[model samples]
Target: LYGLLRRNFRIEEIQLVRPDINLLQKDDGTWNLPITSSDNGAGSSKEAMMLPFIADNVQIIDGNLTWAKVGETTSLSIQNFTIRLKIHSINSFPNMDLNLSVGEMDSTMISPIKDIKANLKTSEGLASLDNLSLNISGGSIEMKGDSTLPSKDKDAEYTATISVKNIDLETLISQFVPEAKELLKGVVDADITIKGQGFDAKADIKFSIPSLLVQDKIKIEQVKGNINYADFDFIISDITMNVFGGNVVGKGTGTLANISNPEFNLAFNVNNIDTGIALTALGQDALLAQGKLSGNINASGNISDIKADGKISSDKLNIKKMGDLTDITAPFRATITKQDKEVNIDNFSAKIYGGSVEGKANIIFGKDGQPHFSTTLNLSGLEAGNALKQLAGKAFLTGKTEGNIQLAGQGTDINTLTGSTDIIFKNGKLATHPIQNLLSVFIPALKTINFVAAKFLSTIGDGKVNITTATLENPQLLMYYGKGQMKLSNQKLAIPSHLLMRCDMVAKMPLVSGAFVREDENWCGIDFNILGTLSNPKSDLGDKLKGQAIGSAIEQIFGGDKDKEDKGGGGIGDLLEGIFK
Candidate 1:
């Protein structure tokens, strides 16, 4: 053999019989060969001893190899491998065919793969995988591919198609994402095509699923979609699913170029969604509301920032609270937008209690993750008695009301409230028992007075509500005016007020009318203070009359000066001036 040619050689056949080999892989994915001192010396003269050979055929039979990496429990074993090579000449590339059958392949990162079989062929620098099949996690995967080796002038190019069928989602995904095991259950299928040159690659993926259950709360049915990826970006289309008794369709685009802060733009349309089911899916009590909901949403953003716009509407929403159900008869509609930690709602409209409401609102999240909100609402022709009974479980007044309210607050506490309200009532009467009881002390006829018109104006801040003006008019009887502040935290009232009546009306009830002082030939007035909580009020009219005569008390209360009486400084002139001012 030493005397034979080393530059050119020919062999008809060579065989490897029942060989077993073990190889170590380095961290960088390169093999680490076992070399002794003598083997090293021989390898140093490898170029001089190298031979170019021509073989008609060569084969390896019953070969077994185990490959393992340093400091890792994961390893791959190939068994019962057979290979055949056919060579025509030393200058021509050989043809090779190989088949591998593995009884079992196991790794810590995935479940064992069983009954693996593969067939591969090669000519020159090109290799083709005719078929590769494996069973894993109660499912199977089939794959085929063609690849070319890289040369000095070009990068490797490859194409592959993979088919996955009925893979156990929880069993498979739990190996990589353990936390999701309890949150997910289902089976999945996919057909994927991948093509690439070196690191520049693209994939087209189509996936389908019969059903998926998430967190034991939501069930998604008939999910199907297709996605295309190229240049680190993904385009998704034709995605549809059913959940919450509704159908949803969606499309989107996303980028993975900067994976830490990847961006996405997505849109979704939902139709005929059951509101109770949707609320329950979001961890809320289903009894809160019931109706059908429809919506469209568009969103764009990166991980830490987002912007969204949408519209939502419903026609038959009924709210349930405290064993009561309130029907909203008109269609409900709202437009919503969000940026970062702030959300804005616009063009919100609804009808209830035979009245219409229109409003806009804004919400902001602070650094501490607490929410602050503000809103303005206009009400038209609302039945006050019905509104009060529905909202408060008691009817405090009966009338038709129109008003506008502007309010801002933090969290859910009413004590943080700051706002203003102006309201007008038509053809109404006070139904509060405490207020009626207090008024009866002034005049027996005041116990059940009906007002033709009433108005209230107030502003809220600093833990108190400032009553800028409050008036009631009964054209046939009397007029009333009041001003005061109410403590918001406790609903306590402190108001100074006056009741003015025509002398003719007073003369009709002379017994209780003694408390009224004649302010003029035509008018009689009684000044009093309203005290106590909003639910239980008290008056000081009896004490004032007992302490002094009605005329002297009235004069003293108004800074009496008979000498300035003619200058519009006292009596009816002064009382009207003070009330209006």
Candidate 2:
């Protein structure tokens, strides 16, 4: 009988159950429920409907089924189920209204959803679902939607909207990002709309959050944004947030579909923010102090085409770097652009230590995808004592200093860095030195001058250092003047330079009121020369004076052979020899 009924029409094995049923369709004839058709054929088949067990309307009421099929596949099943069906003609589908519940749904392989309630209604050519609800790991959500029937080549059309409230982001983020969710605290509210036909779909969503904290170190007061998503492109707008007691505003559009050729442009502005807390919050720890920062910047494009231009300023700002605190009260400007995988810094200018510093740089990516950088810097107007203290944490000299520095290297760690620098100082005091060790080359008065003060000027460049016009005087010892040059390579020191100086010996007390010599003898200044390296330099006051004497004698000897070459050189040499004598 079942084989005959399935030849022309798709019929399910009907279980003549009367509710509270938990078994599959019974195989015995006793549980068989016969379905009959009406025959009244002028416009419709007119015939009295007769069910096998006898009487009434052509429908099933308070009926239960363990399984149902619409086609070849067994697609429906129910428990604690109640359905209303009315079938008038054998050629049309019956009206069906069903209410059912399930323990768990296993349709999604990633995670199982539980406690599903589906209320369905199908009539005419439309279908509607009401009160659809499910539970996820973090929270619960509800959905409502409707759909139209589909034909051969055309797909069903549908519209759906979802609401999410106070979902636990920690739980959600841990499943995806697998980082700490406990160090964070926040609540999320979102509204989502999805509409699709066939294989194409679009989504519009909005989010609002308040009082979010990360590791309890940084806090955001409010955040609001919206996104329009289609395919792989997104348009974001009206983004606003608060951090470090300042406001941040931004907007942009981008496409991540093609990673090699991304396009983006975002203009951002920040106002009167605390630099220390802001830097800390952004994962930097330079220990900035006593400054408020405000700036506007534009960031865009992929790595090969990235660019940035901005101006930043601070008032009386102090930064802790390399275990020293440096102060600055100046404005900074920077412009950067990238081309052919090389990043270029067109200009970077700032002021420090009552001076100005300016430079340019280039960064190229290596085979390992790390940056290799080369840069040049020029510094001026910096105090000698301050610059020394900033670089070495100790001040040995005091005056004004200027310098040029060049650097080139790769890697992110400072330990793997390399560079070279040059410096010059003028009119400074030597706070401390090894002057006593240099008594062989300098006068005894150098100790007293080093103890109190001195005048000095020096210039260094290209691995070579020169010192000129360093003078010292003392009544107890003698007056000394000096100049020299030195060189360095790979931090190894070598000096091959010359120095010319004069020393004055003072005669005082007048023998305690007894007697004395001439006025020139009271403070006899001598001519001298210094030779050799900074490590072991040699002085020759006797030789320099003797040379002057010989040169003078030779000049007199050649007075008859006077060529235009001497001009006043010989005259000046004669005057110096007479004064020294």
Clashing pairs for predicted structure model 1, backbone only: none
How does each model score on TM-score? Answer: 0.62, 0.51
* Per-residue alpha-carbon lDDT of candidate 1 for residues 451-506, written as tens digits (9 for 90 to 100): 89888899998888899888888867778899998897877889999988888887
572: Cα error in model 1, Å? 35
**What is candidate 2's lDDT per residue for 311-407, written digit by digit as tens?**
5554445655322223322222233332224556556565666576677777765445456777787777767677656644556566666777777
Strongest candidate by TM-score: 1
TM-score of 2: 0.51
Best by lDDT: 1
Cα displacement (angstroms), candidate 1, residue 44, comes to 21
